[model samples]
Target: MSASDHPAAIRLRQLSIRLGLGSAAFEAVQNVSLDIEPGQFVCLLGPSGCGKSTLLGALAGHLTPASGQALLDGERVAGPHPERGLVFQHHTLFPWKTVAQNVAFGLKMKGVDAATRQRQAEEFIDLVGLTGFARHYPGQLSGGMQQRVEIARVLINHPRVLLMDEPFGALDALTRLKMQELLLEIRERIRTTVLFVTHDIDEALLLADRVLIMSPRPGRIIEDLPVDLPRPRFAAAGSARFASLKQHCLALLRYDEPATSLPRLTPLGAPPAHQLQFAI
Candidate 1:
């Protein structure tokens, strides 16, 4: 089977999230409210120490809200679910397992029989253009190739909402562009709601249906700008429209900011005490 053809709507109302302990605890996100329609690609754009990941963590069920609602399809997001799949900057693949095994891990967790898991795993592996590398270990692949495996791993579960935390942040410039193209192509077939976090300006403009500009700590949505540029946006750079939106985004990110950068916060309340293992 392919990814869930059914995309889910996301709603947040007056959401406030506090992170850290008594001495250090502060509002990561305060009274934020927004709605993401089914299959819309939205980029959370902001600078360091902003609450982009914090808000995304809440929706993924990794971080709890201090108050207000985080709902998926009108149901509160209490914890992580496969339908709301999250992919991080680094590859979270198993070092010991081959690429196919890593991609199929989610299915294996759900107790699908081995044969069907491998079959579906192959389909998604090919979808991400890693067709013949199924037996290669993550270490055996380049950073971009490993990320492709990570994407295929997440896609194998057919998530309704694809939550990405700067999945290409670590790649080289050329590779990053290719991965961006790959993501747009895959989303065409999956049509899942995507809430991606990024600090890059053009990356947001290139990939999103709308870009949500956020402020520094106690993060709040300051602006919701639509990306009216046409799709297959690779050549959108020369357009007058693209230049205008890029300048606007630059200005918005500079709005109401302190001179010094804030320390970035993870989706977890504080920094993760330990590394997270795959729970899919």
Candidate 2:
């Protein structure tokens, strides 16, 4: 592949993951491979049970792949590191800690001194528009505010890659839109490589440089599409191109019926629902 084909940020090669043991095992992801360019925003999108989040965890090293590899800058990923920050569906801030404290936790873990951590945390908190809430604990913040802190916390580390798993899934519609805009702003300034997971097609198109669509169970990549839409991604739900991409993704996500043979899902064992009652 040329440099344009694989710009060398994150790459997954024939990756597969299994959840359970023996006959009960389900292949959450199988023979999935993808490439993300440096400083790119890529979304892994699929239905609820399609294993998108599982792939995110594997890429972040929170879950081990049953086979294949997750690579960062062409190097194999073994486990979670300071270089990779993950934002989950839930706001993962420490309830007892203040916003600044939560944001500084990663630097502290890396043995960064108090002064440097405070400086770094302040910069990112401001970047995320949460400077005023630095002293407030998670309980004092609203859902959107809490997610902002989570974003600041991760970004403060200056991680080379960000793995986000439905970070806006819990927010109200307006808040979600605002968060998406903020994310675009952050990407513009920092050029961080992002791997985001979401079930919302519109959100994916709004934020991704490319959108990877995965199939049903034994989730494998079904489509790899670049979103060539013009950016400073405006919030026009009525835009013609946006509507077209959204419809295209919706069509891909809608399955006709349970696939009969259910491909072997190379590298992982079979799914848990194989012998039992199954629903797709």
Candidate 3:
């Protein structure tokens, strides 16, 4: 089926996840439910150990929900499927493979012919702005370039849902900003459903169509907010509307903590420094 006809919308019905067994078991995510529309960019923002990643894991079919269910369209997500692609903070590329080879690995395993795999791989490689480096091994590329290869690897498969767990988290500030811009550009071209997990409020405000804030441990969704901002948010970050939204999110995330505990938002239109602290 074409992507338009495919079951792309993701739904979670009272989903909860517990790790371990017996007395040792502890609930990682508790009674959370949310809907992600097809071709939407949704961000999950929370403090560390808040189970945002656990919820994402359940959605990606890497972990089974202890109760309730995660559904794509109407079908239960029982296990990993190619239709649901995942990208994590670290680059999971094959060290021995060239960039082109790494991007084509999935197609190769799916029994696609060599010619088709090479063609598609190159297309995605160029899509992510790595055309000239197709033959370079992962070791030879910068951290940002390696992450681009990882994204290209997943996108070439044409997944219905893309689950990103801080895919740009490990990069330096400048690289992270560029990657975010690249992601927005890519979404315009591919229009895939995306569920991105991040702890940075500004990052969430900048990229998401909607942001869901979760409370600390035994994580539960405390807020479901629409961004309501214009596209090209990188440029809009200094606007009053953007600042208001940022403050709103900050209030929710830091309600219990002291005001001095978290750093203030960067001034309007200022270049964010590499060492700016994120309110986790």
Q: Relative to the unseen true structure, what is the C-alpha lDDT of residue 145 in candidate 2, on a scale of 0 to 100? A: 92
Poorly placed runs, candidate 3 (over 4 Å): 1-7, 256-280
Tens-place lDDT per residue, model 2, 213-258, is 8888789888787886778667556786566567667766774444
Each candidate's lDDT (Cα)? 0.88, 0.82, 0.87
- Tens digit of per-residue lDDT, candidate 1, span 1-280: 4478789999999999999999999999989999999989999999888899998899899998999999999999999999999999998999999999999999999999999999998899899998799889999999999999999999888899999999999999999999999999898788899999999999999999999988888898887888887888889878866766776677667655442432221232243444322211
Q: How many backbone clashes does candidate 1 have?
A: 0
- How does each model score on TM-score? 0.90, 0.87, 0.89
Off by over 4 Å in 2: 1-8, 256-280
Which residue pairs show backbone clashes in model 2?
A: 25-270, 26-270, 26-271, 26-272
lDDT of 3 by residue, 185-230 (tens): 8888887899999999889999999999888888988888888877
Error in Å for residue 30 of model 1: 0.9
Error of 3 at 23 (Å): 2.6
The true-versus-predicted C-alpha distance at residue 251 of model 1, in Å, is 0.5
